[model samples]
Target: MEKDLAPKYLIHKDEKLYFAFAVIVSIIGYLFLIVSIVGFIVWLGFAILSMFLYGLMMAQIRVNGIRLSDKQFPEVFEKVRELCERMEIRVVPDIYVIESGGALNAFASRFFRKNMVVLYSDVFDLINSADDGELSFIIAHELAHIKRNHISKQLFILPAMWIPFLSEAYSRGCEYTCDRMAAYYTNNAEASMNGLTMLGIGKSLFKKVNRREYLLQSSQEKGFFPWLAEKISTHPPLPKRIDEIQMFVGDSSSSAFRRTSRAMWLVVGIVLVIFTFAGIGFLYSDEIEEAVNSIVLDANSITNDVSSDEDSTIMVQAVAEGDIAKVKEQLESGIDPDIQDADGWTPLMWAAQDNNVDLIQLFIEAGADLELQDYYEETALMKAASQDHVEAIALLIEAGADPNMASESYGWTPLMTAATSGNLEAARMLLEAGANPKSKDGDNFTAFLHAKKEGYKEIADLIKQYEDNVN
Candidate 1:
């Protein structure tokens, strides 16, 4: 909401311009969404699939990487905490060091609200070197990117990335910004330069290279292609990066970065990407057409319907229709009282959901498992409470059903479910049956809090009374 504490010199010169264009591109996307719903749907589906694959990749890294903590890499862990305090970042992200075979690099990643930082094993070795500040510089650079929320911003600016050199241009500017913060926080221009050098060359000789001589040779190179190559790269060239840090800390006299018009290349790149996708679409025209037609014919169509097995199906139908005799017949015929459907729904769940107390008792007498959860981990007790089925709720509770059972998805206990519907009877029964009034759901809302939200003061007061006594 307010301006940040960081000084202006820490920001790249052209970062705001590129970010404004990113905002405009997002606006254009919204316009397209309004005029083209089908296109938006396709884009959304592709985005979801891509995110799922990305999550799996991150999970694999987490499983294989060694996490830095108090007991593991304690020095690095302490340094990171100190840096976070300097940056005013309250929550420190999970940091992991992975074996990258021989790669010397680090990166920031995220999924949902959780942030992660990964430092390669080779880069992690720099802590033991004379240029140990190089490791801190790299760590600070990655932390700066996380503080700026760059990965989430990438998703917001995704539409603009298709414009050929635009992605690289923005990325290079981001590198400049992050580099500035890293230098400012680490306060070691030489270590930062050496760190950038290690990225380009290898670990063995980066410490041996002369910084003055390398920058002089890089400065002497004069050609349009060299400038163009720098422009087209997602990261500024290593020498250019090193020079920028020198200028930042008042150790250099020249600007190491410049930007020129990329309009022609932008047009060319957009045309190429469109044609590439168009060609692939042509080759798979039939299959793609069928998929589109099916979606267009039924916009509500999402998941395929899964049918239940025969015994479960009959029991569920009998419960739905209040056919207790048929349910009894099935129970007497040696059917498993707890038989579940393809979706993991059981007969007791169906009976409780419909407030069919007779069938609930019949199933319980026939050895039904009251705690069996459905595909979403919803128990019969939760189902009964959600629908305000008082008789069914009492019957299940008397049969030793857990009054505090919560659903898998929302973490809502049976009392919270009952409070949401303003069912005082169900709430009273649940509370009297020993349901905890202090338990919170996924949104951090307790039954009392939920009752207060829906203007159910009676339920709220009742829950508050129990909450006070319990506390």
Candidate 2:
């Protein structure tokens, strides 16, 4: 019954604001493009390159991925057809399954005139194990994107992407609309919320995840930074999204809900004004700086006696400055190799960050704890991999650092760090030294998935090859 309602009815107020702002930005961008030949050429070149790249990627997926039809996954294919009818989509979009190495994600993308939905293999497996309504909800969510022409709208609004909060606001609104449509298609609010839960925690643990307790945490996400993060993000936080769905399903609203909503919009309005002024200031910065400099020319200046104190420990300074001789001298003088600084950074950790192989070796020989973690629970190995310090990573690993050791915060391994940074040599070193390529972080993302997400194609392929060989 909800599907019968006009699609425009689902569009949020923020979505309308985003579109109006985006239209203004696009007009200005077009005017600039017409006036500046170089800008037009540059934009055209980038647009062509992007289209080509996207087309190639889509072609690869179509060629290599599993296509679902009536013959294969008949029930799922039938459900897709049914949802397409309900959503009033004339063309049934093609569906493909690609290997994600355990990442839980599905996306609907457009290439030229063709619209396609990609379901990560692991997520597909999750859907297969769940009730038909779960699969229906997922498929309908993606189909809703197509039905609403979101992808094409995004293309039209491409120039507005340079505008900070406006573009992301539009994207988040689109997500909310799609979620509503998905619930409408399924007519099962519980299944709809559970689908989002599976995305957050994955299939195995989703059932055990208390929905009320999870949604309750949204009340705690307040203040400027949290509001700014959501404003700049393409998707709303999962808890907020789930709550929005609950509200849509005629759930009774609370006073806390009203307060949070008002606070979020207030932040958005304030940030919008601030960024608009900031953009204006950037355009006239030279004139503004000259005027301010002239006005402050006669301002009183205060002077203070400053002292240059060489106060840090000899060993810490040596490691920080990459002084091999000082490090050797301090080691000979019985300086503790693992002495931490103000932020809990050990000498070896500093050396690792600096990619100082000599200092790393010196600390290792002087009995530095290879497994010593910093304040963030990041080991020297993680630091080396983060900076793509191949030789330093090798030295740390050879000195008995665990390649599979995960950071306490996000369970990010040294391999995950290397893969994310596209450090091929460091990834290879970690993989050869017994780093588990399939090892997942707190979000269940493997090193391969990280590489893929970052568009590090070579590193992703290397991880895939290593994983295949291991299995």
Candidate 1 regions off by >4 Å?
1-8, 222-225, 255-471
Q: Candidate 1, residues 211-304: lDDT per residue as tens digits?
A: 8788777877779787678768889888888987777677877664443553444553444544344444445544543453454324312221
- In candidate 1 the C-alpha lDDT for residue 324 amounts to 84
Per-prediction TM-score: 0.58, 0.55
lDDT of each: 0.78, 0.77
Candidate 2 at residue 393, lDDT?
92
Residue 151 lDDT, candidate 2, scale 0-100: 77
- Model 2 is weakest, by summed lDDT over 10 consecutive residues, at 300-309
Candidate 1, residue 450: the lDDT equals 94
Please write out the lDDT profile of model 2 over residues 1-471, one tens digit for every residue: 333556656655455555555555666788899999999999999999989998999999999999889998877888888888878886678899899998888899975455799988877885457465666778888998887667766666578776667678779878988898898777877888888988899878888898888877776777888877887899988887788888777663642243344224434443454346444544554454344344332221111001011112556777777889888876676556776665667888989999988888888888989988878888999999988899999898888999999887788899999998889999999999999988899999999999999999999999999899886
The numbered model that scores best in lDDT is: 1
- Residue 81 of model 1 has an lDDT of 92
